[model samples]
Target: MLIGDVARHSGVSTRMLRHYDALGLVRPTGRTVGGYREYSAEDVRRIFHVESLRSLGLTLKQIGRALEDPDFTPSALVGDLIRWTEERLEREQELLERLRAVDASAPTGWQDVLRIVELMQGLDSTSAARRQQAVLTRPEGVPVPAELLAAAVLAESDPLVAGALRWALARSGGDGVAALTAGARSEDVDVRRRAVLAIAGTAEAPGAAAVLADALGDPDPTVRGHAALASGRRGVTAAVPVLVGMVVEGSHDVEAAEILGTLSQDPGCAERILAALTGELAAPTADSATRIRLTQALVELSGDTGREALRRLARDDDRAVALVASAFVAVLDERSPEVPGAEVP
Candidate 1:
C-alpha cells in the first residue's frame, strides 16, 4: 500500500505516518518505482501498534523504547504509566471539585471564581498555618462548599487547624452538617471523633442539635462523649444517659458532670441523675477509681440530694471512697451556712 492508501486504511493521518517514518518508528519498508514511500503489511501493523500504545498515555519516546528496545520489559514502564495516569486522574478530580465549588458559590464574576480557587488551594496547603488562614479569612457571602470543609475537618490532624476548620464549618450555618454527619458514621475512629466534634461546634445551627442527638449513640466512646457534652449543653435530654455513663466511665467526667448539673435544673432530670449516680455507686463491680470519680462528680450536682448522697457515701466501707466523700460532704456543709447541724456520717 502507498502512503495515501495506508493512511486511508489505517486511519493514522498521513502527516503522523510520515512523522513516525522520520523517527524510524514505522518505516515504509519499501520504495515504489516513482520513489514514493510504500508500506508493507508489517509496516501498517507497526503503525496500529504505535497508536495502541499511545492510547495508554505513552509518550512518543516511551513508545519508541517499547517498540524497539529488545531488553525493555513492560513491568517498569507499565508501572510508571499507571502512576502517571493516577496522578493525572487525581489532578482532574481536584479540578472538577474546585469547579463544582465555584459553581455552587454562584460566583458573580471572575474575581469570585479566583477567590474560591485561592481559598481551596489554601485549604489544601501543606502548611497548617495556610490551611488555618484559609478558614479564618474565608470571605463572607462567598460560601465555601460544606462538603469541602467537612472533608478537610475530618482529615486535619493539627489541633489548631482542625479547630479553625470546625469554626468555619459552624459559621457556614450547618451547611456542613450533612457532610459531618456522614463523617460521624465513618469507619475510622478518628474520623468519627472529628465528625462529632465538628457537629458539636455547629450545634447552634438549625438542625445541628438533631445531628448531635443522633451522634450520641455512636459506638466510639470518644464520639459519644463529644456528642453528649455538646448535646447536654444544648439541653438535649437525650444526652442524659450518655453523660451519666461518662461519669461512671471517668471519661471527661468533669465536663460531663458540669453539663449534667445544668441538665438537672429540670426536676425530672435531677431525679434521673441522682438515681444513675446512686446505682453506679452501689454496683459491686464498680472499680475503686471509677467509684471515686463518680463520687466527685456528685459534688457538681445541685440540691440536697447530691449532698445527702455524699453523706451516705462518707460512711461506706471503702476507706478511700469514704475519705473523698467525707471531704466533699464537709465542703458542701461549710458552703451552706444554713446547714449548721450538717455533719459527715
Candidate 2:
C-alpha cells in the first residue's frame, strides 16, 4: 500500500505518518515503480501498533524504543505510564473542580473570579493562619461562596481557622445550609461535628435553626452536644434533654447548666430541669463523684426552685454532695439579703 493508502486505511494522519517515518518509528518497506513510498503488510501492522501505543500515552520516542528495543520490557514502562496518566488525571480533576466552584460563584468580572480563586487557594493552604485569614479577610463585595466556606469549615482541623470559617459561613445568610446539613450526615464523626458547629453559628440564618434541630438527633454525641448548645441559645425547648445530659456528663457542663438555667425561666421548664437533675442525683447507679458534679450544676439554675433543690440536696446521704450543696445553699443565703424581697430558707 502507498503512504496515502496506509494513512487512509489506518486512520493515521499523513503528516503524522511522515513524522513517524522521520523518527524511525515506522518506515515503508519499499517504493512503488513511480517512486512513491510503498508500505508492506508488516509496515502497516507496525503503524497500527504505533497508533495503539500512542493511545496509551506513549511519546513517539518511547514508542520507537518500544518497537525497536528487543530488551525493553513493557511492564516497567506501562507502570510508569499508568502513574503519569494518574497524575495528569488528578490535575485535570482538580482543575475541573476549581472551574466548577468558580462557575457556581457566578462571578460578575475578572476581579470576582480572581478573588474566588485566591480565597480557595488560601483556604487550602498548609498554614492555619493563612486559612483563618482567608475567611477573616474575605473582601466585602466579592463574597466567598457559601458552599466553598461550608466545605472548608467541614474539613478545617485547626480550631481557630474553623471558627473563622464558621463565622464566614454564618455571614453568608445560611446559603450554605444545605451543604452544611449534608456534612452533618457524613459518616466521618469529625465532619459531622464541624458541620453542626458551623450550623450553630448560623443561628441568625433562616433555616439554621431547623438544620440544628435535625442535627440534635445525630448519633455522634459531639454533634448532638453542639446542636443542643446552639439550639438552647436559640431557645429551642427540644434541646432540653440533651443539655441536661451534657450537664450530667460534664461535657461543657457549665455552659449547659447556664443555658438550662436560662431555659428554666420559662413557665414549666424549671420544673423539668429540676426533675431531670433530681432524677440523675437519685439514680442508684450514679457514683458519689457523679452526684457531686450534678449537684454543682444545680447552682446554675434560676428561681427559688434551684435554691430549694439545693436545700433538699444539702441533707443528702452522700457527704460530698451534701457538703457542696450545703456550701452553695450558704452562698445563696448570704447573697439573698442583696435582693429586696428575697427569702432565704
Candidate 3:
C-alpha cells in the first residue's frame, strides 16, 4: 500500500505517517516502482499499535521505546502512566472547583476574577497564616464567596485558620449553609466536626438550625455536644437531653449545664429541665461528682422551681451533695444576687 493509501485505510494522516517513517516508528517494508514509500500489511498493523498506545497518554518517545525496545516491559511504564493521569485529574478537579467558586461569586470583570483567583491561591497555601489572612482580608466591598470559605473551613486542620474560615462563612448570611451542610454529612469525622463548628457560628442563619438539629445525632460526641450547646442556646428544646447527658458525662459539662439552665427559663420547659436535673441528683448511681454538677447547674436557673429543687437537694443522703446543695440553698434563701462556686470534692 502506498503512503496515501495507507493514510486513507488507517485514518492516520499522511504527514503523520511520514513523520513516523522518518522516526523509523512505522517504516514501510517496501518501495513502490515510483520510489515512494509503500507499506506492507505488517507495517499497517504496527501503525495501529502505535496509535493504540498513544491513546493511553504515552509520550511519542515512550511509544517509540514501547514499540521497538525488545526488553521493555509495560509494567513500570503503565504504573507511571497511571500516576501521571491521576495527578492530572487531581489538578483538573482543583481547577474546576476554583472556577465554580469564581462563577458563584458573579465577578463583574477580569479584575474581579483575578482577585478571586488570588484568594483561592491564598486559601490553598500550606502556611496556616496565609489561609487565615485569605479569609479575613478580602478586597473592600468584594465579598468572598461562601462556598470557597466553606471548603476551606472543612479542609483546614489548624484550629486558628479553621476558626477564621468558619467566621467568614458565618458572616456570608447563609450563602454557604448548603455547602457546610454537605460537609456535615461527609464520611470524614474531621470534616463533619468542622462543618458543625462553622454552622454553630451561623446558628441564626436560615437552615442552620436544622443542620444543628440533625448534627445532634452525629456519632462523634464532640460534634453532637457542640451542636447540642448551640441548639440549646438557640432555645431548641430537643437539645435538652443531650446537654443533660453532657453534664452527666463531664464533657463540656459546664457549658452544657449553663445552656441547660437557660433552656429552663421557658415556663413550660422550666419544670421539665428542673425535673431532669433533680432526678439525676436522686438517681441511685449518682456519685458525689455527679450530684455536685447537678447542683451547680441548678444555681443558673431562675424562679421558684429552681429554688425548690435546690431546697430538696440540700437534704440529700450524701454529705458532699448535702454540703454543696446546702450552700446553694442558703444563697437561694438569702435571695443573694450571686452564687459562689461549688466546693471541691
Candidate 4:
C-alpha cells in the first residue's frame, strides 16, 4: 500500500507516519512501482502495535524499545507506567481539591482568590509553624473557608499544628462539622483519631454530639476513649459504659473517672455508674491499682452508692485496698455531714 493509502486506511496522520519512519520505528520495506516509499502488511501491523502500546501511557521511546528490543520485558515497564499514572492522578486530585476549596470560599475577586490560595499554601506548608500560622490567622485576615481548615486538621500530624487547626475549626460556626464527620469515617487510624479530637474541641457545634456518639464505638481505643469523655461531659448516657471501661484500662483513667463522677449527677446515672464501677471492682482482672483508681473514681461519685461501695471495700481482701478504702470511707463520712452532694449540671 502507498503511504497515503496506509495513512488513510490505518487512520494515522501521514505526518506521524513519516515521523515514525524517520525514527526507524515503522519504516515501510516495500517499494511501489513509482519508487515511492510503500508499506508492506508487516509494516502496517507494527504501526498498529505502536499505537496500541502508546494508549497504555507508554512514552514513544518506551514503545519503540518495546517493539524493537527483543530482551525488553514488559513487567518492569508496565509497573513504571502504572506508577507514573498514579502520580499524575494524585496531582490532579490535589489540584481538584484546591479548586473545590477555592470555589467553596466563593471568592469575589482575584485578590480574594489570591488570599485563599495563600492560606491554603500556608496550611500545606512543610513547616508546622507555617501551618499553625495559617490556622491562627485573625478572623479579619484571609477569610479562609472552614472546609480548608477542616481538611488541614484531619491530616495534621504535628500536635501543635493539629491543636491550632482544631481550635480554628471549633469557631467555624459548625461549618467544619460535615468535613470532620467524613474524616471520622476515614480508614486511616491517625486521621480518625485527629477527627475525633477536633470534634471533641468543637462539641458545642451543631451535629457534634451525634458524631461524638458515633466515635464512641470506634475500634481504636484512643478514639473511643476521647469520644466517651467528650460525650460524658455532654451528658450523653451512652458514654457511661466506656468511661467505666477507661478506668479499668488505665487509659486516661483519671479524666475518665472524673467524667464518670460528673455523669453520676443524674440520680439514675449515679446508680448506673456505681454498678458498673462495683462490677469491675468485683471482676477477676481488677488489680490493686485498678481497684484503687476505681476507688478514687468512686469517691468522685455523688450518691451514697459511692460511700456504700467504699464501706464494703474497707474490708477488701487486699490489705492495701482495705486501708485505702477505709481511709476514704472516713473522709467521706467527715465531708458528707459538712456538704451536700453536688447539684447536677
Clashing pairs counted in every model: 0, 0, 0, 0
* Residue pair clashes in candidate 3: none
Candidates in descending lDDT order: 1, 4, 3, 2
Per-prediction TM-score to the true structure, in the order listed:
0.88, 0.86, 0.91, 0.86
Candidate 1 error regions (>4 Å): 139-141, 284-288, 330-344
Top lDDT model = 1
Tens-place lDDT per residue, model 1, 83-172, is 998999999998888788888777889988888889889988999998999889877787677887888899999999999988787776
Per-model CA lDDT versus the true structure: 0.86, 0.85, 0.85, 0.86
Worst 10 residues of 2 by lDDT: 336-345
Q: Judged by TM-score relative to the true structure, which candidate is superior, 1 or 2?
A: 1
Question: Where in model 2 is the C-alpha error above 4 Å?
Answer: 65-82, 331-345
Cα-based lDDT at residue 181, candidate 2: 81
Off by over 4 Å in 4: 1-5, 29-37, 138-141, 317-319, 338-345
State how far residue 136 of model 1 sits from its true place (Å).
2.2
Q: What lDDT does candidate 4 reach at residue 255? A: 92
- Candidate 3 regions exceeding 4 Å error are 69-72, 283-286, 336-345
Q: Could you tell which candidate, 1 or 2, scores higher by lDDT?
A: 1
Please provide, for model 4 over 116-203, each residue's C-alpha lDDT reduced to its tens digit, 9 standing for 90 to 100: 8888888878999888887677446445668888888888899999888887776655378788889999999999999998888878
